[model samples]
Target: MPEKQRYTLPTKAGDQRQLGELTGAACATLVAEIAERHVGPVVLIAPDMQNALRLHDEIRQFTDQMVMNLADWETLPYDSFSPHQEIISSRLSTLYQLPSMQRGVLIVPVNTLMQRVCPHSYLHGHALVMKKGQRLSRDALRAQLDSAGYRHVDQVMEHGEYATRGALLDLFPMGSEQPYRLDFFDDEIDSLRLFDADTQRTLEEVEVINLLPAHEFPTDKAAIELFRSQWRDTFEVKRDAEHVYQQVSKGTLPAGIEYWQPLFFSEPLPPLFSYFPANTLVVNTGSLETSAERFQADTLARFENRGVDPMRPLLPPEALWLRVDELFSELKRWPRLQLKTDHLPEKAANTNLGFQKLPDLAIQAQQKAPLDALRKFLESFSGPVIFSVESEGRREALGELLARIKIAPKRILRLDEAQDAGRYLMIGAAEHGFIDTQRNLALICESDLLGERVARRRQDSRRTINPDTLIRNLAELHVGQPVVHLEHGVGRYAGMTTLEAGGIKGEYLMLTYANDAKLYVPVSSLHLISRYAGGAEENAPLHKLGGDAWSRAGKKRRKKYAMWRRNCWIFMRNGRQKRDLPLSTTASITSYSATASRLKRRPIRHRRLTPY
Candidate 1:
């Protein structure tokens, strides 16, 4: 391992510097080193979302400071729903923390950087804080939540929602994972506790809670007036706008109203670059020009083919998003560092105040016996060696493999644990691994040592909403749209209505079928319903209610799907078998073992097998 190299940045704040030919991990390490010496926020701009997320994880290994990701909202033209709540909450939280935190890292994609967001002043005004001993009337609190865009519900199950039951109030605040149960003793607060939504069990008590607004747009009277005026002036009268306008006038927030965020403010929303302080350091992982161009082209293509009805009326692209040229102009205001894996352009290199070359430390191919290769590599190097595997079982197996080769490597659970050791081999868990020759460190992941297998990144330990439930919101349903029931064939969706059966009251989705037959499905069974999606809604066929014909059609569909799946599996299996044949010879037997090990290390990418 080579000694870690340190380069000096230019003296002036606005000067640009280039760090060329560095891999993702190497660039992250350099950023971490620079962050250690700096005193303020560090912004790392990746070319795309995947790279932004990957670099965020890599940078986390180097510093304990807050590392935040500002993800793209991913709004497409005529999208029926707002961006995911998690994505919105993360962006707002980062914005709120940027001005206050002593040091932090913000990773953002170019698309997110170009998108317009609410001004810092607007967000600061909406943020609310509560303490255990704080005194507040229930009526006042409820009104405040409603004005801040939180929905009142009978039960709190998701973020941006609150429920009140007598003296107890349950609320899941934005920018937080769990909901808080606030027990109030009349006007004075009694206690505050965080509870699990699944079990309704209290986890722990907290003294205070800081809450960010549930929606990005303000819901105050003045803001609503602004939205109403702008919306009426921008487009001709349409059914969708009229319906939304009525809801706004009545002080009710309609679903997917976030699409109209630009109208909520009287002044134009600012680009993300406006939030950063003047002295804050900016690092571009690749060329911003290329990223901006790609985003512009993709957006234009999506807008042209969206096929949304004109009456529904989407905001023009310019009103909601920034132009590529404008984003590039904003990029010029920051003191910048450019990290490039490939050769830098002559014009950029000449204009940069200083240039530093980072060594390339990529392993092109692995040898036949990885364990033997590892032993030899360790003997030839005098720096730290970290072997990262995905699971505890694999970590234990790796330790045994090393023991079989008469080598004892230290077991490290965290990166901080490896700081004191030099010329040591440590095993830990990581997503992907690489060797940093500049830091004299080699991070050999299970995949790289064994071969590429299907590896799925470990999901965070949070409850995930079902995919079918996320496809479309119930509010987005129209009276005449086609819908599909898992057990029944396609039917035309009638309006939802309250129904009482067996002395129980519930909301049901009414579906009309052939011969004017009707089927009422309980709202609790929403997971069983899906919007008919393959073709135009008008072309969908209506099924007869209580007919065996629908069952027969379902059976045929299942059989066809099973046959297609079987053929795909057989093709993949035969291809793998043919590829394995080359490693069967005596000269390549060790390579075959390495390949098999690699397959085991790779995360399984295949979907779960189901009985047809």
Candidate 2:
């Protein structure tokens, strides 16, 4: 059997507890252990001196040694560094090639020190890499974790994650995956393992690494250079500026060379370098709390405050049901408006109490009451009204009530068709009360109550209105009139015929066009079908068959249809004006003042702060 490699050595049980106390100190101890095992002086690199100090202090206590060369490395000098990129590049070249005094290690958090390392090529132990086709390649699976980056305890949790492209892969594997291997090949596998998300490992067997500093990892050099230059202008005067000038003056800095270190490396060296060991214990502080209930409660409270009740009608059931019945009675004229119901009541029930036959529906207990206000409203208004129903049962019940009340229904329209009908009185469900046209308020009545119909028809200032009735009237499509086809260009619809296919029969329209060509279209394709813009009646006798004029007319109609689809009806109401609705004078003044205060106090740049 092959030997098993041990990644974590067994530490005394108490050692684990001691490690927990110091987040930074624990990391130092881990790095020291690895350095001792490797018999090399480790170099610890950090973004700034403060980070270096914290790490250094922890390591010093563990090793009881002052190997931190505070003077030689940290105190280097630099000058004439116009662009920060140039200075950084010069320094890294010196550090990477500079032979180790004892055991050198670089501690660079993130790619700041290494720059421009393609995330795709970064590999860490048990880290996941995603390839093309959104596939993941995971190594070193911990059954409990099974995936990297997912169960990690780090804040802004990242690392041990990999994604793949057609032939490329990206992995942010942390310490577990050292010098993550990169596989490149032509329909074959070529592997190169180097990089640690924590900067722990480096190229083990590669001949040369075209490594750039952690900061240059991004593909855009200009952007990185710009940022680095800006950062330098602000804070670069410290160790980095000093080190560059000293190296350039001494002629120790290399020209045109950028040192790139593996993520697995302990440290990134430039102006300063210190020691770090492999397998350093790094603990991230902060907890991520999951509270779904809090979010749900907050959202519920907001809706409740707005008077939105999901389980019940926006208005009381008694008020809503009564108004609905009064509206349905007025739409029973058209044949197409016949209400379809499962079963009819043995006799008409006084669904609307103390009402008989349509118009007398005005005879309610009290006209001013909220439940009868709509009936009073209908009687007082001089304009025509159209009521549409969506549900069959409601339509039928409403039809019976309307019949019992003796109110004439002008039109029953499908919600989609009626919105554009341009009638004076248009009543329908407001589509979840959001005032959208997608929903239809339908009125249907049963068979015994033949007085109620599914739809009605009425004349309007612009055109005749009745959704159900209009649909039935559309049945009389003429040969010369323009008709739209789902696929074929606009042509004159000659006539309708039933075609038998596979023992099934379907009705289709025969359309003859300008070229003397004919096309067959099925009725099921109604959405794509529509009528041309010519009036219901034209001045001259309609021409037979097809011509250029019809095609041009069809195109014009299609364009208009597209524009119509984009149009939406909007009702604007300011709640301040709504207070005029019979509110007490004293209460109105208080409400207005409160509203004014709220408006004044609100921040101009008000931002919604999401609850945690």
Candidate 3:
């Protein structure tokens, strides 16, 4: 190690430094160390939601500090539908802790950090805390719930919903997973019991319960009036036809109205960073700046296209989100940070913890000695190896696999248990493994022992399919071939053509019907087309536009579907003890369709393969 390059964390309240080459799960370990040394909690700004969630699980193995993940809405920037109740609940719970969070880790995705959250005063002010022996006001509490954006329901099953019947009141708090059953003795103090949402049975007792606002923004009369006035001032449009304005006037939270979060408050909406304590440290990783640029470009495109629609107008991107420059300005405000720079090459520094990545163990399953490489490392390695599996089930499965080779490993829960040189089993969410030379320990995961698999990433955000989609592009078909259109029947395929319609240019499939009549269909509508395989493989007859033959073909398809469904019901009715049967599957339907296609001219024979 160099004289200046040390492994110690940032000591000051606000300091910006660089950390690099800290690959794989070592990032989580470093983050855990920072939180312990700093006076305030550490806020990790992950590149995406998947990366944030992975660190949230792995960091706990290193530190006992409270770890929480501030979840994203998982909806697009201007999506019409609101986020799920559970996601909102998780977010509110985490936000409530941020203000006075003495020490811990808060993982937030970069995209989520850009959006403006509810004002800090709004969340803390609206929150209601109740203790077991505290007196309860039935009528006042009911009115408070309604004003706080909670819905009155017949049964309390989801968060932000409450059900009341006389003395017994059931309410699912925004921060809690289960509904609480409160038994009130008139207006005096009573008991609070946690109950199951599904079975409606009491599970246990609780000393105290913290109740957060049902929605991020308040929906009280003052908030609504403020929103309506701000909407008029900002939009400067006719409000009579706008559904959002109408609903706000009536104190109704319309679906997808979360996009208009800025309008709900008379004061300036605060950025996500404002919710954190002033002295809190923020860390940056990966290509966050590039990702933010991509997100901004996408949002701008949506803004331009959505301008024409009067029913729901979009707020300026700057109003709802912070720009990349603004994010960096906030990042520099943190007292302790390890920010990754895109332009400059990293030098050896105090922040950098030199943890080498573990070498891959290519386990050949087919060979007699599949564990040869792993065995060699286990025997030669000087430090203890903590093998971290993604889940408890994977840890058990790994133990069973290693036992065949006579390598009995001891299972432990924490990193402190790996004291000496040996194999230990631990469950974590590490994507890759690393070895800390100074600590004399190495961390490995299931992917190291096994091999890589297709890791699932964030799915609900903006996903752009190139040139339409894989299903839309019929690149397998030659320029000249017979194709079947669900609505227009048989046509001769003539490849794809691009044209401008309504001032928007797009690709379309060019198909020619009988007598040289041509039809152009958008490439996006590929679900309406299929390969022609009805009468003969190569000699599919082209149906003329506005012809009877096309209508007859559709009728035949409907009958075949009906017949297949009826046959399935008949077989299941007289089954030989069919259990755990799937109601229906696309594969089964496709198999039946293929078999029926082979014998189109005759009655199809039923093949019995049990009821399921």
Best by TM-score: 1
C-alpha lDDT of residue 302 in model 2: 40
Clashing pairs in 3: 13-335, 14-335, 15-335
lDDT for each residue of candidate 1 in 367-434, tens digit (9 for 90 to 100): 33335555676667666667665555555655665564476778765454555433334433344455
Candidate 1 lDDT (Cα, whole model)? 0.67
lDDT of 3 by residue, 1-612 (tens): 011324555545456567755767878877777767667888888888777777887788778889988988867788666776777898898888889988898998888998888888988899998888788788888999999999886666568988887788889999887789988888854889999865678878888888999998989988888898898887754557347888778777777788899888877678888888866777767777887888778778877877667888888888888888987787666754554422236544434455777776756443335567877777788888888765554566567666655767789877777887878888766667888766767887766665552122222332222211112225445566888776677888898888776544556789999999998976545545667666674678879987889898668998998898678556653341244333332223223333323321111111111110
Candidate 3, residue 230: how far the Cα is off, in Å: 1.2
Q: Worst ten-residue run, lDDT, model 2?
A: 332-341
Candidates 1 and 3 compared by TM-score, better number: 1
Better of 1 and 3 by lDDT: 3
Q: TM-score of model 1 relative to the true fold?
A: 0.75
Query: How would you encode candidate 2's per-residue C-alpha lDDT over 1-612 as one tens digit per residue?
Result: 011221232222112111121221224444444444433444443434344444543344334333342211121111111212222333333333333334433333211221222222222222233232222233322221322112222211123334344443333333221324445454333454555433324345432223333222221233334433543443323344234323322323222112211111222222121111222222111110112223234434543453332211121222111122221231111111011112223332101111111222212211222124335535554433344332343445344444433564544332223343232212332111111111212111121112222222112212122222121123446667675543443557678777765444456677776556776665433333446544553432233344445466668988986665334111111332443323233233233222222221111110111111
Best by lDDT: 3
Off by over 4 Å in 2: 1-19, 23-30, 39-49, 57-90, 93-95, 98-102, 111-114, 117-612
**Order of models, best lDDT first:** 3, 1, 2
lDDT, candidate 3, equals 0.72
RMSD versus native structure for model 2: 35.6
